[model samples]
Target: MTEPQCPLHEGAPRNHVLEDQCIRKGPRRGMIVASSKIYKDGSAEVKDRLKDGFAFEKRSCMHCVDPGCVSVCPVTAMRRDPKTGIVTHHPDACIGCRNCTFGCPYNVPQYDFNNTWGGIKKCQMCNQPGVERIDKGLITGCAEACPTGATLFGTRTALLEEARRRMKLQPGDVYKYPMGDVSKPDRWHEKAVPVYHKHIWGEKEAGGTNVMHIGAIPAELLGMPPLGERSAASISETVQHSIYSYMALPAVALAGLSIVIQRNRSQQDDNEGGQS
Candidate 1:
């Protein structure tokens, strides 16, 4: 038992424990893609911020339906799990070309160019390297560890519903929201509800994403990528397929080669006559 004046609540959550390495481990090892904050007092607040005053943004992968990260990888190092649709990187297959980093519109991929043994990095959403938290019927580390029900995991369908429902709620109203997976919530976090920030990230940007987001910060601050309904994969596929579909590109190449050969032969014949 503590003193009467001492206020004791539940425990605070730890974000992706592995994520700290990305944020603060070393120049070569650490690369922070996500961040969080706490207001000293519930009364203190920032404009366009979550009303409850706690703010965090995990700038992880958009997990695009047609991800460039997967398409641009020459060695097939990056791939999307067909069953779960999680985009993941396979280190063994990687040739370290860094095409994925350049191809992605969201700038989600990370490269450890500082080390002698460099590697590509990104949040696999706990689905990589056989972690399979989703397949094992569990949730992501950030989602499970989030005490305020801030980070959550679930199908795109359920998450969108929860996000839309929150937007309709009255701000400042105390509400008990589900934590972890929305379908089978692990726990609850009750707080004075904050006003919706007006966007549910990863919904349709780049043709939608598996892991979604909703928070106070608008456009730039959220590190949200500007994308349209169509994914980069679709556009690339369309162009490549159209060019090759009729074998027209091959005809063009053959024509160019024939012209070069004819010019070479004509020059050689002229040179022989001059020598004679």
Candidate 2:
């Protein structure tokens, strides 16, 4: 008898993991298409879903309401845009301290160690000039590339509502899943929903994130670790603010100490002169 072959080894030509299996399910008003056969891959070929499909697990930046990178950037290189609430980085102002690296819990920031003039690189949510998809009322590159609606882009409130709705779904129930950016649904995938873990990954982690995720497997299995409510950045900022609340406090203390020392020195000089 022939030995059983591993499902992964069968090389199933990359299973369709997107919610919609139909080729004609995009905003193009034609066949659903992917620009490339392999969107992304892992070290091992068979370990996870091949490039054409979505995985059971999803992870994204825990866009902490209180972010650590924002606190640690000395030159104000990292900032949260008030309009979108997306974390933006300014390479021009960056002094390359790498303080943000130590502060980030998600480890999303990447360093450009290869460059002679080293700098940092991270997901700017496609907000840079010319690549401004979100600004133009479009989707981010990752969200656009994702056929499964896994990586969604939307307002924090809307995304949170969508995630909550998904959690309420019973397994095997048909649901309409939005794809390629929630703000503008250029594409859509419809299918029977997979059973999801009760908890939303970024709902409350480190005081919440704008980008959210829902998955069948636990977050830890998807490379996300369990975290506490207090974000590292929040803690650092609290300590910093407490110590430097007012300039007047330090100034007054210094002035009083200086006056005492000067008076003592004058008295000592007079006593020495009289004795001489």
Candidate 3:
């Protein structure tokens, strides 16, 4: 039997060659090229790039609007800023209970099990006091680091608009996609937009998220699981509120139980007195 040729061989003179063909070609030789005007003018130039079906995907923070980590943290280590809508954690207060790990739907919270002290760590969007990227008018490391505009950082609303715009583009059209932080000026790349799958992953997953993602592949294929409309944190809060809606409810229940026990004790005391 003959060995298969590498699909990415450069001498094949094609975009992609089969392993059995033993060919080579230049990069993107067969791949569709995007229009340069899209980057220059900020418009969608392509549509229907997907030879296969497409799905919509967006880059978003894994934690939903109301995050499970914020709700289940025993030491109040997990906190969400109302204004920025960023979820952050205080490692000093964290007992390493791993509650956040169990609570998160996306399984984003990671633990440093290898540490001698054994602590938990996860992406806080590089928002430490000195390393505040968003506050400093910069994007997170991942967004800045991404060579392709695959991951973008911006206000939730603006990112949604960009996603919608891309969905409208015809395949093979070039689009100038923003890179780094959307709130501030940063690096940008112009490239042909691939046929998208048609769903923004973070737009409404578990009631939305701050970060968002766009991808050529289906999110499910990338290990992102399906989720319900309501975020896990929202569900937990509703249950807690229902049981403790009113402070008086617990107080009243406690009083009634106490009264019944007291009456039983009094009856027993009377019976003992009579026998004596």
Which ten-residue region of model 1 has the weakest summed lDDT? Answer: 3-12
Off by over 4 Å in 2: 1-60, 241-254, 267-276
lDDT of 3 by residue, 1-276 (tens): 000111111111232221221111211211111100001111323232233332323222354578889999988999998888888778789998989878987665656555688665555666755567667866666566666576667788888888888888887789887776665646778988776778887787888877655655555554466887788888888888887877778899999999999999999999999999
Q: Write the per-residue lDDT of candidate 2 for residues 20-92, one digit (tens) a residue.
A: 2222232111111111111223443432334333344332234567778888888999888778777766889
Decoy 2 TM-score against native: 0.72
Whichever of 1 and 3 has more lDDT, that candidate is: 1
Cα RMSD of predicted structure 3: 12.3
Which candidate's lDDT is highest? Answer: 1
Give each model a TM-score: 0.73, 0.72, 0.69
C-alpha lDDT score of every prediction, in listed order:
0.67, 0.62, 0.61
- Residue 258 C-alpha lDDT in model 2: 97
Superposition error at 63 for model 3 (Å): 4.5
